[model samples]
Target: MLTYCLNEYPSAHGFENGLRPQLTFICKAEGNEAAIPRVMHKHDERFELMFILAGTGIYNIDGRGYNVKRGDLLLFNAGVLHDENPHTSDDLLIFSCGVEQLKFEGLPLNYLTTRSQAAVMPSGHLYGEIRGIFEQIWQQVMSKKRYGAEIAHHLLSVLLLLCRNIWLENNPEYSSADSLLGQKIKTYIDNHYKDEIALKSITAALNMNQFYLAHVFKAWSGYSPKQYQTRRRIGEAQSLLLSTDLGVTEVANAVGYDNVNNFHRIFHNLVGIPPARYKKFWLTGHIKS
Candidate 1:
């Protein structure tokens, strides 16, 4: 077989809006009991792409639950809070990569797609191809050979382009007005989750009536304002537990729960496990069924 010259192949267009992706990290959890359940968390400056290599699981993304299985690719856009707590008996295995400085045309910085799009998409016919690409990137990064970073960077660009193509294929549609209002409500909650704010006061501050505010918000997002606030509080608590060495009571207080017992009850209700045990499983990497 003769080697073909670059001019012999078809021409290709470059990325739109000068998009350049920087790979921050690659994480793989396979056949490990400690890897099933990850505490809820968010990345302000990076987006994450995770592929379920084997097993079925449920992931909480942006205050919603998504059932995922093999051949599923999950996208966690920048600033989108998410968590994973698979069943104890399932053999869940996943490979994840974090990308920074990514922005498609008309999208926010570090965001792969709009918030309205579904975060989990079936890889379909591309599953094997995409999985191979991820494995190549992982191998390149782990080898530490010459030009490893450069190779991995190019591979990451390929992965992102594929993801964008798939997202485009999905053809997600949502009203801009509703998305904006939902964002405003979410922003208010994010800024004031520490406070004991009520729906009436939230509506007053936003200058909208309770009924309209509630309707629009619930329509735009699956959760009500109250439910969203509670999840936000618990998500922060999860982060604090994994990142800090503070006691459960201190974590509760930090997340705005004055009563320690109340904190435990709410945390258990939302997380399906006690706060202290959540931290322990994360640390030990094994869940005690």
Candidate 2:
């Protein structure tokens, strides 16, 4: 009898440590003759690293298609849209490991954000080492041995480190400061939207030139620092309006707009309505005529 383990597989919620990074591995055992359909899926805030140990398939990621074969390693970032379709009748043995809570670690955030899937080619000595590690992980899963989760996590970490080395070696011009700095800035703005945050304060904290930082940050992040900050603040205000009993003025102030009139104007300019009416529309899901 061919057994399949999908939803019944164990969850990795208990693997979180208080300080270090956490890795999760989920395995599936599907029959070789199964016809897997194509579907679109996205992860909310976690990155996925997938390896195809056996079988032939085609994967569509970020609107680009890749012809995948055995011994192919793929990396995908958070919020990316991807799908998989098996082209052959052979049951696909796949390993999908998710890495969460990633720190800067001297790598650019753009490395994670860019939605390009490159196959890790094994050419030199590093190729064999990488392939061996993946094979060991695959074997552990197939054997259903004790402590497989722990073993898989350790292997996954080594895989990530190897990939990082390859990326740095290939792209010499990439900068952790230029790529990761903006993400740090955005994260800070998201958390502190309710407080008083200024360009000067941010530049000082980040130790970057004010004008140059703003230009490069906007160029890379697709939003000016101030614009991104305002958007986040308004988004928070909108959420509060719909979910809480807070008044318009309270919501505006809570999102860092001290002047109610200024908040009304900005809210109207962006949302096409004043704060009060916007809140009502959101609550009722009604469009004003």
Q: Write the per-residue lDDT of candidate 2 for residues 92-164, one digit (tens) a residue.
A: 6766666776433433331343333243332245656766776777777667889976786677666776766
Worst 10 residues of 2 by lDDT: 12-21
CA lDDT of every candidate: 0.82, 0.61
Candidate 1 residue-wise lDDT at 206: 94
Q: How close is every model to the real structure, measured as TM-score?
A: 0.77, 0.43
Quote model 1's TM-score.
0.77
Error of 2 at 23 (Å): 2.1
Colliding residue pairs in candidate 2: 32-91
lDDT of 1 by residue, 1-289 (tens): 8898999876654365676789999988876463435545699989999998887776867644577888999999898887676554446678999999887777888887787777889999999889999999999999999999899999999998998888888758554887778878888987898899899989999999999998888776567888778878888998898889999999999999999999999888877779988888877866665
Q: What's the alpha carbon RMSD for model 1?
A: 3.9
In model 2, the runs with Cα more than 4 Å from the true position are 1-20, 28-35, 104-113, 116-128, 135-151, 170-289
